[model samples]
Target: MFLTPAERIADYQARGWWEEIGVDALLRQAVAERGATLALVDPLNRKTLDGCAPERLSWNELDARVDAMAAALIALGLERDDVICAQLPNTVDAVILFLAVARLGLIISPIVMQYREHELGHILSLTDARAFVTVPTFHGHDYAAMAAALIAERPGMMLLTMGAAPHGADLRALAASADPASVAPWCAAHPVAGGEVLTICWTSGTEARPKGVPRDHNHWVLNAKVIVWGTGMQPGDVLLNPFPLVNIASIGGLMLPWLEVRGTMVLHHPFDLSVFLKQIEAEHVTYTIAPPAVLTALLKQPQIAASVDLSSLRAIGSGSAPLTPWLIEGWAETHGIEICNIFGSNEGMALMSSPIDVPDRTERAHYFPRFGAEGVDWDSPVSAVMRTRLVDPETGAIITEPGRPGEMHISGGTVISGYWRSPELNGASFDGEWFRTGDLFEIAGDGALSRFYRFVGRSKEIIVRGGVNISPAEIDELLVSLPGVREAASVGIPDSDLGERIAVAVVVDDGITPPDVAAVGAHLAAAGVAVFKRPERLVVLSALPRNAMNKVVRADLRAAVLAALES
Candidate 1:
């Protein structure tokens, strides 16, 4: 048993696998692995991004800063199990805040920067965050104003600001003056236990209220290591992440993997095509994840044909929006770079592919990992660390035979146990021990997963057109690719012939509008989408409405589509 367990661990490690280092230990390891390595880089402004030009930190420097921030928070009377909320973009301060909170064993609940009074208030109140961190202003909105509004509701909350100090908030100046040696001793005094909750993730409230996802140091560290191994990450690789640091994509996509591999990350503030392409060239980025919207804009830019030397890029991954097969094949043939797609949710389940795993356009468009890659066949030894399964959606029973479509359930070291404080969801979220992935899928006979696992759409958002289910994501992907359309969203409107008719809400690019319903139909027909899946009507919108996290408010759009039909 000793040798077998050791062999199992060794197998995983060779593939960049780890059991569970936990959050506290994860930071410790990053400090120890290559203390002198440049863990993060921002080319936009080296000084602000890295602290100074040639701005680099050894493990000692990062550890010291984490300690100082931890001690400072403790000095401010923050205790174990307390929650500190941060509302900021992808900045050095936000990184420091997470490390500091982890050292003190305080839960770090980070909300997106775009969140206003309403969304901000709900998260703050729900977490009962004792302290808050923010930037004075970003883009065009007043962060201080929003923070102040929330603070008024929760008078006991402590407010901390970055960049500029607001009237009612404490400045960040004192943190720099604090001693790191003292903070290290403080971390030693209050060590983070294995099962302690380190962060709270909010689920997308598409159908119901958003539930808080509480993850502990152990689960987070384990998940990060799993992601690193699964995605085939390594040292010296540069990862460009357009998703804000607050999202789960940031947590699993860049932070953990880069830290574990002792790699570099080129952090971008916002997704700007020119800036993004320039950074990829300048920093020699090897990996990145952007929404399909970003990719569409990049291809349209004329400068891409001449100025961009994209040889350094190895793999490009996309999510947060469905990626079409057309986009995947077009980019690969054009740039000679592999485009991979990932399916992930906040429910602690994710499936990611590598350049090798998804070599062609079809794989990039549709393949998702099947469950029980290892646990299913004991006779056959499997090397992959994570295992997946397909099961009946209604009964939650395991599906043994192939060619049957069912929901995907994944179990491995990375899957989280349950949502924070939501006992009601636990039963539905898990099957025995595997995290029940909400995605519906069908595993092929050869044990090789297809590039296209049918989304079957969201449970509530599924369009029942004459009793045949139609996923909005499927239609939305096709609609967005049309000429003159910047982006598209679909919802099911009432219908007499069919149960529901597909209604499309689209944002047309400059000097473009939806032609006639017949014109739209003709375009879909050209694209090879089934006639039934095509939207019967199109509504032009200035922009698709998004929540604080940049997720489309599909429910709200459905309501609008219904109203438009009635009107």
Candidate 2:
């Protein structure tokens, strides 16, 4: 199922960015070296995803469970290259299932737990998944019924349930019943190649149907190495992961790195502030990742901040929104914790600003030093692997000047070859050897060794007000600095005269009065924002609507404002 070009693979191997080692080999090495060491801790008790109890596993135990499960899956007629669609939370079972699929040389497609019949149907049909795994009920949704409905339509598909198995096979029973003697030999017989596709992860699908991004073993390994380089994670460092396992943040950023370093991973699902803080203190967590808004929200709540001991934290990674300079600086100045600004995607784009790379907190918030820029080499290993360029969106010419917005194009070992089964998307997404990121950025700094890149805004996300392009990120960044603002999202609303008008939706601190449009305009003016870029309308909400990945959904916000005005 691997689709990477042979020439690209040769280039990556020659540059030492990738090797022939796969994830299964890495896991086996970790088990051999640290068999008795704690490998995973699941504190959520599966209440959010299922009604199962809490789980803890050592390296050896995790390996045994994965082997047993893999053997059971093989007995059920699942073979190498067969797609297993799994919709589970960040639990021990999810991790075990991932490893089992890798061990059996099978392809696993992880679906976010939030997906319902509409999204699941499309994914299952597209992938032709042989086996589907889910919890009977999660967050009050009856997944069994949904699976039953789908399985009825596709009789060839097999269903496997985690907590309760009313419609299909019982996953827990299958694992428990598999004999190790038989399982070990079966796994050994089916050897997995490092270049084979390991998983198919889905995109956010904001504009159209979600596109599947298939990543191979080398892709995951190289990505994990990049994270290890940027964060400087050492062996035995405790990591707390709250991100869903379906995406790159978890699989590449945390899970695969944990395997590389043989560290303990504490998993948390359904992000609760109290639980997150407790886990950090209890697990002696040295690193974790969070959205910028969550980091700021924690700072605003002094009571919560004082309740837990965050002294164990050395660094925190944040992205998915424009980071505020204050939030990054305040954590370092007050708590002695560094915030690493990470910009990544499922397509294999990774840009990071670490404490060693960008020591100044304010600079870390807005700029990422171009990895392979001329004369800008750093100690980071990823810098040697990644290549980046910015091109004028309209003219299709490369941009070199500072402060000129250009769409970013990246090529690297970690980047995916193309979207799964979507030749049209692949055709539109790639330009020669580079993958079009659809992100707008401007080069910054002067000297050759000091060149950096600043995120502008998503090309499609720019608000067009009366023919002038307005960057929503610029407005949101300014608004977030306001005293009472908790979070802000700028979106375009339809107007009678102009095709669109700038509208700002804000979430203010509890008991604080929401700022009106005039007050917001004054603030923007004082900040030196041009008049055309000023927001024309303001709406206050308890919280901004976000997707599972913590990215603000501008389309939803725009629809809400339009509905109110029309009503």
Rate residue 149 of model 2 by lDDT.
91
| Candidate 2 local lDDT, 1-567, one digit each (tens) | 667777777787888878966789889999999999999999654554576778889999999999888878977988779999999888898899999898878999998776666567889999999999988887777888888898789878999987656788888788888876666676668677667899999873223345799998989988878898888788987899997788787898899999888999999988787888999998999999887667887778767878889999988987766687899888988788989988888888899988888887778888998887555667777788888889899999988778899999998888888889998878888987789988899887567424689988666665644333456765677787776788888888765335468888888877899888898888876664556667888877777878999988887888776665566
**Candidate 1 lDDT, 1-567, residue by residue in tens:** 011133444544465544433466766776777678767664475344324343345567767767777767877788878888888777556777887887777888887665555456667878888988887776656777767876987878988886555534553565766666666676667766655677886654322334567766655676666566556667668888665666567877777677677677677776567778888998888888776666765666636744878888877877655567777876777787767676665555666644544455676576654423534432111124467777797786776665677877776545566666566677767665577666666655554543234444444466655433466765666566677778878887766335468788877778776665677777766654445666788787778878999877877888776666668
Tell me the TM-score of each prediction against the true structure.
0.74, 0.82
Quality of model 1 by C-alpha lDDT: 0.66
Stretches > 4 Å off in candidate 2: 45-49, 205-207, 448-450, 461-567
Worst 10 residues of 1 by lDDT: 374-383
lDDT of each: 0.66, 0.82
Question: Scored by Cα lDDT, where does model 2 land?
Answer: 0.82
RMSD of each: 10.7, 10.6
Q: What local lDDT does model 1 show for residue 500? A: 68
Error of 1 at 84 (Å): 0.5
